[model samples]
Target: MIVDESIARPIAASEAHTIEADVAIVGAGLAGSLARAVLVRAGYRVVLIDKRTVPPDEFRVEKIGGRQLDLIRQLGFINDLEAVGAPYNRVLNIRDGKVVDISVGQAFGLSYASLVGMARGLLSDPTSFLIDQVTGISCSDDRQQLELASGKRVTSRLVILATGMASPLAYSLGIKRRMLAERHSVSFGFTIARPDNAPFEFDALTAYGERTADGVDYLSLFPIADGMRANLFMFRDPTDPIMRELRRDTKRTLLRLMPGLQRYLGDFDVVGQVQSWVMDLSVVEGHLQPGVVLIGDAFQTNCPAAGTGVSRLLVDVERLCTDHVPRWLETEGMGADKIAQFYSDQGKLAADRHSLDMARFRQALTLNNDARWSARRKLHFLRRMITHRVDRIHPGWVTRVRGALR
Candidate 1:
C-alpha cells in the first residue's frame, strides 16, 4: 500500500470509521481547524473530526505566513507558537552568486517578518476545541454526522469537509478527486548556530543560486523555526538535469541538496522525518450534493513551497463565512451557485494566479536565468524600498508588520 500520513497511525484501506456533529468538520490540519474556529465564533456549535486521534506535524512546512502571524496573535496561539517554535526575518534569493536578492531582517517595506517554526500543537484551536478525530463523515438534509472507525457517531446542523487531500470522504460525498503525482516537492537542511547573532534570533532567508539546463527549475533555501532551522529544496522540471540528481528519500535528499551540511549532521539532526505528498492540482467545482461544504485542503491542495498555503486557506475561510453561508442558509431553493461562487473564485486564484506565481518562482529561482534573477533582485529591492518609505511615514505600520515578518 502507498504510505499516507492521513492519520496519526496508518490504517488499512478496509478500516471504516463513523461520527457526527452540529457542524461536522473533517481534518484536524490548519485549514480544518481555522474554518471551525470561524464558524464557532459566529455562534455555531461544531463537532470536528479527523481520522487520527493524535495528528502530527509530519509533512507540514511548519512555517506560517505574514497574514497568519497576525491571525495567530489575535487567536491567542502566539504563546503556543512561542512554547514550541522558531522565528524568521531575512530572505536570501540567490542564483550562483551572479544574481542575489537578499531582504535583510525587518528591513523590507512590504515584507512583514513571517513566522516559521514548529509549534506545541497544530495551532488550530477552533476545531481542536471539539477534537473527536474520527475518520468518516455522512451528512443528510436533516442534519450532518461523522463516523469513527470504532462505530462512534456525532451529529451537527452543518458539515464542513476540511479533511484535506487524504480524505476518501470526499469521493463518498460526490466531490471529484484527482491527484498530480508531480509538481509537489520539498526538502530540508539544518543549521545549529546563528548567522552572526545580534538582538534577535529569528529570521527567514530564501536561496536559489543553482539552476538546471532548461533553466526552468532550481534549488532553494529558507528558514524554519526561526534561525534554528534551515530547509534546502531541490525543484526540477521534467527535462531539468537536476532531476537526475534527486535523493530518492528525504534524508539523502537533504544531503544531496546541501553537501556542505555533511559535517553538522549530528549537531542538528533532522527533527522531523522527510515527507512528500502528491501536491494535487485538483479542484471541486460544485459538489454533487448540497449541505456539504468543502473547505481548505479538501477543496484544493496548493504547493506549500511558496509559504502561502495557510494564507490562502485563511482567505478562503474569510470569503466563505463572510459572504456565502448566510445567503445559502436563508434561501428556500439554494443551488450550487450559493457555495460554488466562493469555491470557484478561490480555485481560479489558485490555479491561475497563485499557481503561476509559484511556477514562475520555481522556474526563475530554480532554473538560474540571468534576466529572471535580475528581475527578482529589482522586485525585492522595490518591495523593501516601499516598506521603508511607509515605515518613516507610518511607524505603526512597521510595528504591526514586524510582528508578522518572520
Candidate 2:
C-alpha cells in the first residue's frame, strides 16, 4: 500500500526546512487514515505523513465488519464503495461437491454487515482529513518534526504513529517490534474478470478441507463480489510446482489445483493474485514513549490466518483516541509511553485469542486427513452445542458455528 509521490515539484526553502502541528501521524494505511479522520474531526491541528502517496488499486480488505463499515461511511467513502461490493451472507464448507457444513453467517439472522471486494484506492483515501501528505516525520533538535521525502519538515506537539506494520518514525523513537515471517501464512481467496455483474449469492463463503494425493490441505471455492468470480485457497507447499504457477499464472493454476472451482467459475474468466500474511509484527511494543503512541498493527495485530487484526486495531483506536486519550489529557496529561503499554497489553490479549482461534480452525481443517478426524468431528459438534456462550466472547466466530449447524 505504498505510493511514490516523489514526482511533486520542489518547494520553497522556507517551506521545506520546517513545519509544525499539534499531532503528527506516520503512515497513511487503513488504520492511519482512520486515525487521521478521528483526530481531524476532534479539532487537533493534525499533520498526517507517509513515505509515499502511490495509492493502492488491487486487493484491499475484502469485506469490512459492521462497525468498521460505519467508520468508512462516517469518513464519506461508503458511497464510493457500493458500486464494487456484492452482499455476502453465508459461509459454506463443501467436500467433494457436497455441502459438508453450512455456517449461518451473521447476515442471515441479525443486522450483521456484508463484505465486498474493493480496490486499494478505497482502502487508503484519508488524505483529505490531513494538513499535508507525502511528508515523512523526524525530530528537529528537541521537538518532533515531519520531514517529507521531498525535504519538507513539519513539527507537532502530540505525535500519533498510525504508521502501519513498518513504522519508520516509531523506529526512530527506539521502538522496534519484531514479527515472525508468515511462512505458515494465511492465503485469501479472491476472483477477478468474471463475465457478468450479477450479485454473488448471499450464501457465498465456503471452506473445503480436502487433501490431494500428497495430503495438502486447502479451502474450497465460492463466488466473491457478485458471481463474477470464485476461488479455492489451499496451503501452498513450497515443494509443489503449482505454488510457483499459482503466483504467476493464478488463472490457470486455480483451475488445475481443484476441479470443484471449474464448475462454479468455468464460464467466466477468473483472475487473481495470491496474498499471504508473511508479516508477523511483534516488535515496536515500546514504540510509545512520553510523546507518542502506537496503535493498530504498528503496535501488534495478529499472527497468520486470523482475520481479527483490522477489527482489533479499530477497537484499539476507538478506545484510545475516543475514551482513554481524553481521560489522560484531562487527568495526568500525556504519558505516551504508558499509553503504549496499555494498548499493547489490551491488544496482545486480543491477538492471543485470535491466534488461538485460528490455530484451532487450522487444526479443524487439518483433522479431516488425520486419524483424529472422528475426534475432530466430535469437537466440532460439541462447539456447535455451546455456540451461545462462545458467541458472547466471539461475535465474528459464532457466525462460523452457525454455519456448521446449518
Candidate 3:
C-alpha cells in the first residue's frame, strides 16, 4: 500500500461520533499519553486505554532534558514538566578520580510513573482515558476494533500502539521485533542519600569507567522527588556474578568500580531496593500495516546509557499525532499507505537511527579494545579535558561559541 504524503483528507466533524473516537491509543506510557494529549487538544476525539490506572514505579527513563525538553515544549507541556520534575542544570562528568568536563543545561528528574501521570493529566477530559487491558485487536483499512479484557470493545478510525516492549498485541498483528543487540546493556536504578541526611556537594554527577575491562559506561547520580537517584549503566553480561554483587553490596561495588565517585559523594547509603534492567536494542518488523502504528518501546527499544529513549519516542509522538494521524482520519481508511508516511518521515527516521547508532557507539566505546578504539577512547576524554580547561579560563565561552554556530 502506497500513500502520498502531500495529501491531507479533509476533516469532517460529523463523522467523529460514528466511532468511539477519531483515534484509539493503546497503552498509556509516556508515548501513548503524550500522543493522546496532542490529538485530543487538536479537537480529535481520542480514547486512551491502558491496563493500570497508575503507571508502576518502574525503572524506566527517569530524566528528561536537552532535545527531549525542546520537543515537550513544542507540544505545549513545558509548564506541566516544571510542575512534576526536579530541575537541575549542572552535570559534573568525571573519570579516573579527576574532573573531565561539566555539562550545563536545563534538565528535569522524575520517576517514570510520575512522568506518565503528568502527561496523561494533560488531556482536558479525563473520561477519554480507559482503564482496561486490550485483550485483542483487529485492524483494517476502514476501521479498527479493540477487545478489552473487561469485555469492553472500542472502535476508532485509527489505532496507535504505544505499548512498550513485550507486546503480545503487536505480535498478534504479525509484528515481530528484530533484535539489533541482545542483552546489550545492563542498568541499575536506585535512590541514595547521605547517611546523616545532609545535601551532597554536587546537584548531579556522572562518573565514567576508569578501566575498559570493567565494562562500565558510567554511573549517573541526580535528584528525583524521592531522593538522589543513581543509574549505573554497563556493557557486561547480565548473568555475570558481578550482577549479584551489585545487588547485594551496591555501595562497595560502586566505589570499587568508580572509586573517584567517593570524593563528590561523601558516605551515602542506598535508600531502597535496587531495580535493574537488561536492555535489548530492537526495532519492529512488519509494522507498516493497515489501521495500526507502533510508537515508543513498541516500535524500538533503546540503551539507557545512550539516553535516546525519550527523544526517539517524542519524535514518534510528534510526527504521528501532530502530522500523520489527523490526515489519515480525514481520508477514511487507515491503510499501510497512510502509515508509511510516518515510517518514512525524515525526522522519525533520523531519531531512530541516532538511537541505534548511540547504543552501538556507547557499547563499543566502553568495551571495544581494538587498537583503533583504544586511541578513540583516549582522544574522547582528552578532548573533554581540553575543552574543560578552556571553559574554565573563560566561563560560558563554550556555550556562547556553540550558540553562535547554531
lDDT of 1 at 364: 53
Of the pair 1 and 3, which is ahead by TM-score? 3
Clash count, candidate 1: 46
TM-scores of the models, in the given order?
A: 0.64, 0.68, 0.94
lDDT of 2 by residue, 205-239 (tens): 45344443422345433343334333333444445
Clashing pairs in 3: none
Q: Cα lDDT for residue 156, model 2?
A: 58
Q: What is the lDDT of residue 308 in candidate 1?
A: 60
Q: Which lDDT tens digits does candidate 1 get at residues 1-406?
A: 2212221121112222332234556665666665665555554445556555445545454455465666566554565555454444665443333324345442211101222212214334333344444566665555556666556666554567777666677776666766543554444333334334332222444434333543322333344333344444445443444443432344454445544434433233343333333343555643635557776667766665555666566666666654565445544433444545665675436543574367447545555548867678567546765666687687668769778996
Candidate 3 per-residue C-alpha lDDT over 159-256 given as tens digits, one digit per residue, 9 for 90 to 100: 99999998999999999999888999999999999988899998899999989989999999899998899999999999999999999999999999
Worst 10 residues of 1 by lDDT: 108-117
Error of model 3, residue 84, in angstroms: 0.8
Decoy 3 TM-score against native: 0.94
Question: lDDT for every model?
Answer: 0.50, 0.51, 0.89
